[model samples]
Target chain A: MTAVQWILENLPQILELTVDHLLLTVPAVLAAFLLALPLGRLAVRLPRLREPLVGGIGLLYAIPSLPLFIVLPLILGTSIREPLNAVAALTLFGLALMVRSAADAFGSVEEDVRLAAVAVGHSAAGRFLTVELPLAGPALLAGLRVVSVSTISLVSVSAVLGITSLGSLFTDGFERGIVASIVAGIVMTAVLALVLDLLLVALGRVLMPWRRPAPRRAGSREPAQVGERGAA
Target chain B: MTSLLEALDWVLTADSWTGPGGLGVRAGEHLLYSLLAVGLSALVALPAGLFIGHTGRGRGIAVVSTGVTRALPTLGVITLVALAAGIGLTAPMVAFIVLAVPSILAGAYSGVEAVDPQIVDAARAQGMSPRQVLLGVEVPLGLRLILGGVRLATLQVVATATLAAYVGAGGLGRPLFLGLRNHDYAMMLGASIVVILLAVVLDALFALGQRLLARRPGTA
Candidate 1:
């Protein structure tokens, strides 16, 4: 059957798998982001912690996803078939990547701005929330975009472990020689990643209303440039 | 703890170490695939990236392609190719090369772009051709970041090459998928341990190489 016809007939299964894919991805990315924020800040704030923190993260990130998934069940005391194992492994992968970006994001905030907030009698917490976080918003968002895309793609790998994500399509399709289902999975995954990326961009706009598209002129810096630089 | 010990026992078994499907043979296959992919990818991506970075053109292509490729699921790529190619080395190799190209491309361009503009101007002022400037000046200075990209790509290929087993191509993944099929967790864990060790050892070697390159007089 043609790939199009195959997809049309399997739409329900496809939808179910997409939901499974998102269930694994969204939580993992969110948890990684939330946890990475503090860890990244500590890395930046404590010079002593910077090397080991980032270095260790880089080391862990180098582990293959399949192996990490296989070994995680043992480490987390979860059953081999548990989806939680997939989520935890993905969180580690995402967190490993995002921590460096998070550090660079917070580090990108100017010292002058922090001092200025302090000079105006803002408490340490207040300055971080009002001055530092907002100023670091663009870079953090850029980092988050990478994490989200990566997590979304990596979710499919869990299907091989029988955890059931869109990746299941690939494994099942290969077994049955169904090219269409595999194609559908690939398209759906890319679409999910694109939609999430756009949503994050929109969210960034709403959260930082001051950051409009920079006017292109001889000297004006482009906002898109910031996003590029922030990515690894 | 018991499973971990079982996995260790599996690894230590002489039978698991010597056969056609043994860890040594599988690991050699994995290494061979990874090296070919990373090497071929660098050959294609490095010059293109250097050109873009040096000329300050096609930066958009680099950025967009990198984002798109990064979003492509590794499993999907390998499975699809393996299906079409009839389950051989071709699919995994193609997928690995595809996976590695963007990284090496991004690394080469970014490394060159990160070079100080004043230095490029100094080389140009000395009447050096663009080729001479790129090779003699930018490449040497940017060697650390450039090699950093290769290191990352190599590691990625090594890790992903395990998927070759899914397509009936041999690698350490042979035991992994075999264990999965037979419900052998110890075998799965054992193979995974070897894969992880390979990655770590290669990573350490790359780290050492990067440090040595950095120590060269011109690189810093």
Candidate 2:
């Protein structure tokens, strides 16, 4: 069948799966970020906690998702049929990735910046909120973008365990041997992921204006140096 | 603790190491699949990245490709390909290549771009060809990053290749999948240990390689 014809015919089903894909990713990534922020901060604040906090999560990230997905139901005493299995599995991965990125984000904050904040009569909590987190925005947002995009992709994996999502298209397509459905699923997933990534990039620009390139004159561009701090 | 011990006991048993579907055989299949995928990924990405980095072009392509590759769900790709190809090791290998190429490509180009221009200029002043400069200077300087990306890709492919079992392909995931299906926890734990151990070993081996490739600051 022609690709356009197939998409036109399956528009309703496709739209439903698209929603499923978004539902699988959006809340899970937010939950992971919520868990990761404090844990990532703890890793930075306590030198002794760094290895276990970061390394342990990294190890958890290394565990295959399919097994983890299977094992979560066993471990959590939840039914395999429940949506919790997929959500928990994706959250673990997002949490794992975000912890390291969050630590790196906070770590990227300069000592001078902290001292300056303190010198300005800011309390510890106030300084962290007003100075440190702002400085860490670029790195933190970069990490979030990665985790969020990968999470969107990973929602497809849960289809194997029978959680209906855009990935179900691939599963059902294969079972029914409908090549058009599989291609449509692949195209839709790719478009959704790219759209989400671009959205995060745009959000980063809006939220962290300091990270964006400055408006320049139409002519007379200067190549001052490679890798120099952007004219921030 | 008891489950851990039980898993170790199960793994140690001779029967687990015997037969066509034995742990040893599975490990071999696992290694072969991962190696093939990594090798193929490096082959495709390294050249493209090298050209882009050397010529200072295709940055957009690199960025877009990496982003897209990172975002495409591997499980979907694997099952779809497997379904199309009618089952074999090929599906998982293709999926691994897709998973791996972007990192390797990103690493290669970024590694090249990171080379101090003065070094390249020096090579040019000394009458070295562009090829010679790429080979003698940029590649060695960038080898660490390139290998770092490969190492990361290898770890990922090793972990995810186990999903081959979902499509009726064989690997270390067999025991885990079957064990989960049949309520054989020992088999699950035993196989998981093997899988994790393999991943750790790959990680450590690359760590050592990165160290060995480390050139002293004053020397090449």
Q: Is the docking of candidate 1 incorrect, acceptable, medium or high quality?
A: medium
Give the least accurate 10-residue stretch of model 2 chain B, judged by summed lDDT: B211-220
**Interface RMSD score of candidate 2:** 5.4
State the local distance difference test value for candidate 2: 0.82
Q: Mind giving the per-residue lDDT tens digits that candidate 2 earns over A130-214?
A: 8988888888888998888788878887776678889898888867877778888888888987788889899888988878676
> What are the clashing pairs of model 1?
none
TM-score of decoy 2: 0.86
- Candidate 1 overall Cα lDDT vs. reference? 0.90
Alpha carbon deviation, residue A227, candidate 2 (Å): 14
**How do the residues B114-184 of candidate 1 rate in per-residue lDDT, one tens digit apiece?**
98776877888899888898899989998888888999999999999889999989999999999999999
Off by over 4 Å in 2: A1-10, A43-56, A71-82, A202-212, A217-232, B1-9, B180-189, B215-220
TM-score of each: 0.95, 0.86
lDDT of each: 0.90, 0.82
Best by DockQ: 1
